[model samples]
Target: MGSTSARTETCKSTSEREIAALFDRWNQSLQTGDPRKVVANYADRSVLLPTVSNTPRLDAAQKLDYFQHFLENKPFGRIDSRTIEIGCTSAVDAGLYTFTFARTGAVVKARYTYTYKWDGSQWLITSHHSSAMPEK
Candidate 1:
């Protein structure tokens, strides 16, 4: 995962629970096993630092490329710990999580941070950084 800085200002309209729900929705998208559905949660210009891939995906097509292969593994993630920070139009959810791959029956523990923006109508992920736990 790359380095990112979050704004210090607190959110005026968004709640912690709502931010948590956003993570939930993203997790659900992954369960669908569709790259397009997973990419839908992200903005057109979003960045994805994936857990298994070293490439940094910076656009929709690149994200789709990464997910296309990832979806084949049938990944499901569960959050173990999280910290949420909300700004007026942006928010960050950073945490530790675990993923189980149905295809291989493998479990991987990881660290992730998803940054989102409230783009008028809905919250969209602007950046998502994930990496496997170093000690693994």
Candidate 2:
């Protein structure tokens, strides 16, 4: 009788810096002012709880609709503070961010959380939740 040993494999965790940079990539997408470009960052099966919209976006089409309107203001985002957590093939970045609307000159402070998954070739956002801050 022969006994076989069980083997365990360790997954390499993504760096916090890399997770943090994902936000920058998403933000850059916003700079394009093209909803399609913005939506490209998200996975096909993803959720977007937007900062400006009451309705939640559950798919790429819904997300495209939201971003189409949101992008009209020419929004630009900057992170105020964030904490990132890395996993085997997933990561989360959550914190405060400020958005400056070029078209309207409106400044909004919001809290955001973005969860990402590595899809073999690239990282894609799986869930994104954002809401304006309660206090001024």
Candidate 3:
């Protein structure tokens, strides 16, 4: 591979690594009930297609609005895993996650996938899809 291509691969891998870290960070932020911190890793135009809720937003502010609502219930979670697959400037991550609410003490375990794109310099999340596991 050319040096540029190699760099792109490195970038893609780095993004996948960061996605795992971001999940933990985001979950911690959610535990804290702070929307801004929770949404920090997402791109300005990111969309969260959660299998948990009905609210959908087009921008950060709108997304945060959804987070704010979620925070009202003191929602929190932990990401247990993350795996990445990259192609060109696109990357996809699939993993298992768990959530705990301070108020409800409910443990929400689920599977999640995040899609990101390299916007030339930085890796930004373009889409986030999450689905909850059936209660056992």
1-136 in candidate 3: lDDT tens per residue? 5556433244444645664655566666777668888777688878897756876666888778778877876876666877878777777878888877777787789888887777777666788888888666
lDDT of each: 0.91, 0.92, 0.73
- Checking candidate 1 for backbone clashes, the offending pairs are none
- Give the count of colliding residue pairs in each prediction: 0, 0, 1
Q: At residue 88, what lDDT does model 3 achieve?
A: 73
TM-score of each: 0.89, 0.91, 0.72
RMSD of 3: 5.2
Q: How many times do residue backbones clash in model 3?
A: 1
Worst 10 residues of 2 by lDDT: 6-15
Residue 76 lDDT in candidate 3 = 63
* Tens-digit lDDT string for candidate 1 (1-136): 9989985654449899999999889889988988999999999888999988999999999999999999898888899999999888999999999999999999999999999998888999999999999994
| Residue 130 in model 3: lDDT | 81
Candidate 3 lowest-lDDT run of ten: 4-13
What global local distance difference test value does model 2 have? 0.92
Which residue pairs overlap in candidate 3's backbone? 77-99
The better candidate by TM-score, 1 or 2, is 2
What TM-score does candidate 2 reach? 0.91
